[model samples]
Target: MYSFTGNGNPTLVGQLSLAAGGIGLNVSQDGKYVCVGGVASANLYVYSINYINTTATQALSNSIVFGNSALGSNYDLNVRGLSGAQIEIDGLVNYDNVN
Candidate 1:
């Protein structure tokens, strides 16, 4: 839960926890829309941006890792759309519409 306001350094805003065995992360274009998914399970997390670093900002968005609980060693973690790329599944288009 850290953020940087364009010029200044990063700061902690909040803290979130994943329910173990989480998998996917989808970020929208405007630093918003952070979605975390659970591995082989049915769960998702949505977060909002507090701040971002100008140089090393990726860590602010990529820190969403798998949790510890029923994780069982099978967490297929993956991140997508943080760069505003569109995803398609079975000819269906998916977009990060986070604001």
Candidate 2:
């Protein structure tokens, strides 16, 4: 993650290493949380954003791993509201002979 000043260049704010390959990302409207969806791992990761002084930080808050790994690729993630931590993810799950 990075932050930009009014007249300065983008600065590195925070970073998180995912356990698997990440294919989708979404930030909450309030800028308090971020969601990362994995492709091969078939997992959803949630992180909480915190600010100390002026620098930003991210901490892993939650994660869910789905049983169907084929459904992991090419997904889109978005926050449902501005005040809540709800997320909406939509994608195609490649099942055997099905999409």
Candidate 3:
């Protein structure tokens, strides 16, 4: 994702590797999750939004950002072995087969 600064200039912020180039990607209505539907792989990926608050002394004072924090272990359900499940190389999403 590319986020714009206060000046409205875009900057490279983050990325996710999916099973295939996703044609359908969206953030949840509640703004707490990101969803991607993969047609080629027949998969669904749900990612919890991670926001970090920076204090005044930090570079991005009083800002929220996608930090490099790991999701809780259960966030990625693939390891529990959903039947015939496939996980992306990045393992950044909760996996499920939409098909």
> Quick one: best TM-score, which candidate?
3
Q: What is the C-alpha RMSD of each candidate to the true structure, in Å?
A: 13.8, 15.9, 12.0
Order the numbered candidates by TM-score, best leading: 3, 2, 1
**lDDT by residue for model 1 over 14-98, one digit each (tens)?**
4445555645665554554465667677765665533323356433433323222233434333334545657654422222222
Tens-digit lDDT string for candidate 3 (1-99): 455457967654444455456445665544656666766877766565654444657244333233232444434333343566664443233233221
lDDT at 7, model 2: 78
Better of 2 and 3 by lDDT: 3
Best by lDDT: 3
Model 1 lDDT, residue 58, Cα: 32
Q: What lDDT does the true structure give each of the candidates?
A: 0.47, 0.48, 0.49
TM-score of each candidate structure, all chains considered together: 0.29, 0.31, 0.40
Residue ranges of candidate 3 with Cα displaced over 4 Å: 1-22, 62-64, 67-99
- Residue-pair clashes per candidate, as listed? 6, 0, 0
Given candidate 1, what's the lDDT at residue 10?
Answer: 62
Q: Between 2 and 3, whose TM-score is larger?
A: 3
Error of 1 at 8 (Å): 35
Candidate 2: stretches off by over 4 Å: 1-22, 54-99
Candidate 1, residue 13: CA error in Å?
Answer: 22
Runs with alpha carbons beyond 4 Å of true place in candidate 1? 1-22, 52-99
